[model samples]
Target: MPYSSLPPSAFWKLCRNDRDFLLSDIYQPKFSLTPGMRIATAGSCFAQNIGRYVRASELELVDTEPAPALMPAETAQRFGYGLFSARYGNIYTARQLRQLLEDAVGDRLHDCTLWQRDGRFYDGLRPNTEPEGLGSEDELRAHRLDHLRRVRAIFDTADVFVFTLGLTETWTDTDTGVVFPTAPGVIAGQFDPDRHAFLNLGMGETLEDLSAAITLIRELAPEIRILLTVSPVPLTATASGHHVLRATTYSKSVLRAVAEEVAALDPGIDYFPSYEIITGTPFGARNYKDNLRNVTTEGVQRVMSVFFGAHDGLAPVDRPDTGLARPSSDPDEEDAVVCEEAMLEALAPK
Candidate 1:
């Protein structure tokens, strides 16, 4: 009798029978995201997709490290500009996100975060930003210092902050516990098992790190609203001894639970089900590409449709004329996500 009073959304059979599961009724925005709001996005590669939709819509997506006016769009993307609000490439872990905010405010100064390869230097924190590396350690540090200033500035001006949780497994310096975006050697530095350690964060640690990152975000931007989502893209490779499939599940589980817990604790924070839209069993994985790892354009469109529908009151399904732009036919113009984590695929022995 008590269960009969619940809405259709509360019953699995009712939701399963709906024509489109991603209906606007599924998500009611806690607060509307108007065109006037300044939004900043960061996190794993999937977050790049979120930034793209935000830009396509009337919403203002902040960009602090913009490429030069003359730079070609493709070239700018290759050099890690215009991917997100800042050039902080692929922040793949909650710990890394928290560390970045701390570094922005000079609370934590990490030494030995520089990598050298082929006679050029790279900032280990964001090795992929400069694919060829900088001329010297000084040049790299100067760029990184400037980036920190911009990162701090983004938070100061942002009205809404969107972060996508990507992975629980991260690599950290054994001595300082400072996290690197990628395994050192995979991008630039030489890997030393003794100096570097692989950490698989549990639910407790993931929750703590994300909570702290949110706390820092609010401290810097007192009125900022935080939106959290888990990256639905499967891990490219797993350093853990367990099979990759198992590892991916474990990583996502921890990240998803942390997002839910954090969102529940604060009215300023909200969780978007982008993860479910792409990976949920109900969809039968229709959103993934042939590789079954990369999300298809249609999948991304659906996610954005739901997002815009909730935030901007657009139609959630079959949105032919929504404010969001359609994906370009040319793959080059559409632009593939620049994922440093995918670099690990090179290490696999043929």
Candidate 2:
């Protein structure tokens, strides 16, 4: 009886058998977006794609810390200048995001360790952002201070905050419990079993970190709306000791569930199903490119099309021609998803 009263979308076959597969009915946005809204984006590597597409649309993607006028676009990107609202590179875990917010507001919850390689020192929290590492610890600290100031400005100005949940697995400093974006030794730091530890966050821990982060965000900007997404990209490698396939499935399942639970609890927060659009059976994994990891241009376009279409008066966002040069056909060169997790693959026994 209940089934009969529900809409056609409630039935799998009704939507699945349709010619276009009818994605329009899937996401009814909790709130409408206007072109004038200043949106701030931060999260994993996949979040970069969302930010790019948003910049292409009529909506404004807030860039608090932009590249210098003289720096080339490619060079700016390499030094982590133009990615994700601020240059906070690849925040791959909810805990890392929470710590960044705390540091920004002067909570000083965790004193980030400085990772060193050769004579250079890297910010343990964002090692990939400075590929060559800074010349000294003092210089790295100065850069971090300026970075946090810009991050605070974003919180003060943004209308909507978009975060993509990337992974449940993280590496943390044993002494301070500060989470790092990448595992130690993956990018710059030497792995020390006694000091650095791997953590796979459970459902409760993930929920708590995000909820706390939201509380801090609302404190800073009382009216800011939040949009959450789970990245469709699979894990590049797993330290969990399970087969990578099982590890990927587990990580994604936990993250997707966490996003759903968190979004349901708050009227101001919304979850977008970009993860389902790419990974669901309807696409049959065709959304992934030849390597079966990186999402293709067509895949990202489809996800963004549905997102912009959900807003009542706005036309679907067309993927803009950024005119950036494409890399060679090597699977590695396909897209500029600056994923530090991908570096783990190299450590696998050759």
Candidate 3:
């Protein structure tokens, strides 16, 4: 065999054997995260777990707009504190993330996207952002405006932004073609087929949306290094007619492809194979909890371990108190994963 046959990563232990691939070759990070680096996180619920791991590690993980100190801890969780830099919960699609940035930068508007539940207005885009729902239309507008402003600040200044791409499945407004975090009926409004439609974003559309997001980030924060990862957790349900398993495969496959393609577009952009680390059969699927949709404690630890190890000077992060790993244990600190899509399962007739 010629010396040119392989690259430097091939010699690493995890890559030395066929079954041991375990992401050693594909895991080389484009840049390193240091002790004081200002790391910000967004995207799906899994991205929330990433933020917790980073903070527990005693690193400088920045949360630009924290919840008010006087708020009850449980109130804070329901309102989406410590979930991400901003309170927008579970941006499950690339289009949602892109729109979030656009909204922050004042390039777009979706004020009418709010949903009414029994006459109470909930920012349908951030339905979980206010657990009790906002007091009035004026209050909702004020809160969302503040969130967008803080989102802009978070993106404009964070040293490294880590986003875990989640799902291709989405429900959108049929008439306006606007995307919502979940179908209006599931959480707040009445389910009207004439008003709502289902969309399973394909590879091309996902890539285009992601590319625009990266471009906007660069425009706002040129030096911001991007660390993209696909959430390993599978979809809870499929809006598409395909079997749930098949739908899960397709969603993850497209997200992984987009992460690779978009990461290649910028020198500072890097794709972390946390998806492969968990889903790779050789890993024995140890990363997922019994439900399989929720990631386990050990899984989060291993992913962050690989994340820090792949870099040059990052010290390992400590495991947070178990309370912070799952919402069931301690609602305030964990991956209070605002999984709105899961509500669709109840819609099925027994």
Compare the candidates by lDDT and give the number of the best one. Answer: 2
lDDT of each: 0.84, 0.86, 0.79
Q: Write the per-residue lDDT of candidate 2 for residues 288-332, one digit (tens) a residue.
A: 998788898899888888899899766677776543566768765
The reply for model 3, stretches above 4 Å from the true place, is 2-26, 70-73, 322-336
Model 1 residue 232 distance off true place after TM-score fit, in angstroms: 0.5
Candidate 1 structure quality by residue, lDDT tens digits, 177-239: 999999888878988898999999999998889888988888899999999989999988998
The digit string of per-residue lDDT tens for model 3 on 1-350 reads 77567775556553646565645456777886777788888888788778778777646677877879787655666678877887878898999988888888873457557667766888878787775687788877887888888888896669988888999999888776778888776777666788788899999999999989988888899999998999997887887999999999999999999999888877899999888778877677677766666777777777778887776687777776533333455322234455666666677779
Each prediction's TM-score against the native?
A: 0.93, 0.96, 0.90
- Preferred candidate (lDDT higher): 1 or 2: 2
Scored against the true structure, residue 194 in model 1 reaches a CA lDDT of 89
- Winner on lDDT between 2 and 3 is 2
Model 3: lDDT equals 0.79
lDDT of 1: 0.84
For model 3, what is the alpha-carbon lDDT of residue 48? Answer: 76
